[model samples]
Target: TSEDSEPWHIYTDLGYYSVELIAESQNCGADTLLIDSIIHVLNPSFISTIGNQDISIFPNPVKDKLYINFNKNLNNPMLLNIYDLNGKIIAQKDILSVAPGILELTFNRNKTQKGTYILRIQNTEETIFETKFILN
Candidate 1:
């Protein structure tokens, strides 16, 4: 429940949602109102050349920094994006290349909040990799 008139978040699976509001009074009877399919939660997905299991990032629940570890060598510059639950890009970074072995790509953390986030690594053509992580 919310105290003010501002909006709130309801963490759930990807699907359409409807809101229902009920008002009750001691003197008067109860009234109900519902708006169907107002909110839509979509899965952030994209077609890419690489598979999801091909890359891995350590410390799933990261705190200060995020380390992206992978074995594949990439010559193209990778575009890193950090997205919030609402599919908003909270932070991003551009890397020149990824050498074989463990590598870390750090970005600004001032806007990161405690919630599930999506880390998307892409190239100039299309999205290469995408996964979800938690921020503490």
Candidate 2:
């Protein structure tokens, strides 16, 4: 309608998005416009604290397995844990220092429910990274 001069939209997932808008006029006919990668949506989860800037995760709203990637090679063994917002440990794994510095682990679907989770990656000394993510 004419009230849609300014419209709002919501994206349910994290990825690059393209938007297409078509305008019609009685005398001017119709015109179409498309914008590629117009809206880039990221994980809506809130990260509490991050000690390291080199760590990252993909495919947020993770299902079965969560992939963790380190931008640099690791020098120490790492401990990865997933916890609820209330600080309950849901899953934990010991990730030894490897050649590629990339770690992968599976989350049991029958164990944890869908919600926001905090991922804590640590070494023997201290916590290296902690970020919140959504689980599907």
Candidate 3:
């Protein structure tokens, strides 16, 4: 039999048995018995920290294509600006109409040195969100 909090015993018809105990407390009950198995409930909200902005980037150490997802529709034109660590603007693009969804941007890694760079996204009003990536 399986249980969330241990102290499990397995017995055979031949009179042989083995026991195992997990030194933890179960919130359900201390003396709860499991003839077969027990199921444990999980709270999903405790699994991850979901934020407000809800923007994400993938393939962090990106070589070419970088994708972004925005949680909400943007009122102003979104601006993407890429910069090297030295504060020099390498590339800039003004996205005219961005629906609330995922977007893709491609970078030529061949033109970029293998190092860390910063990607900044802003709106017409200059509210900015920044993320860092490495070229390898």
Q: How many residue pairs clash in each candidate at the backbone level?
A: 0, 0, 0
**Candidates ranked by TM-score:** 2, 1, 3
- Minimum summed lDDT over a 10-residue window in model 3 is located at 40-49
Can you write out model 1's per-residue Cα lDDT over 22-120, one digit (the tens) per residue? 777899989989999997778533322244465788786677777877777788998888887677988878989877777665545675557677888
Against the unseen true structure, what C-alpha lDDT does each candidate score? Answer: 0.73, 0.78, 0.63
The candidate 2 region of ten consecutive residues with least summed lDDT is: 1-10
lDDT of 2 by residue, 1-65 (tens): 23366654435578998988889899999998999998877853444558888888866869878
Q: Which consecutive 10 residues in model 1 have the weakest lDDT in total?
A: 43-52
TM-scores across all candidates? 0.60, 0.60, 0.56
Candidate 1: where is the Cα deviation over 4 Å?
1-52, 105-110
The residue pairs in collision within model 3 are none
In terms of TM-score, how similar is model 2 to the real structure? 0.60
Candidate 3 lDDT over residue span 1-136, tens digit each: 4653323222222332333333345665444333333322232111121232667777777778778887776667778888876799988988876677888888776777666667788776664577777655
In model 3, the Cα lDDT at residue 43 comes to 22
- RMSD (Cα, Å) for all candidates, in order, is 5.5, 11.1, 17.5
Point to the candidate with the largest lDDT: 2
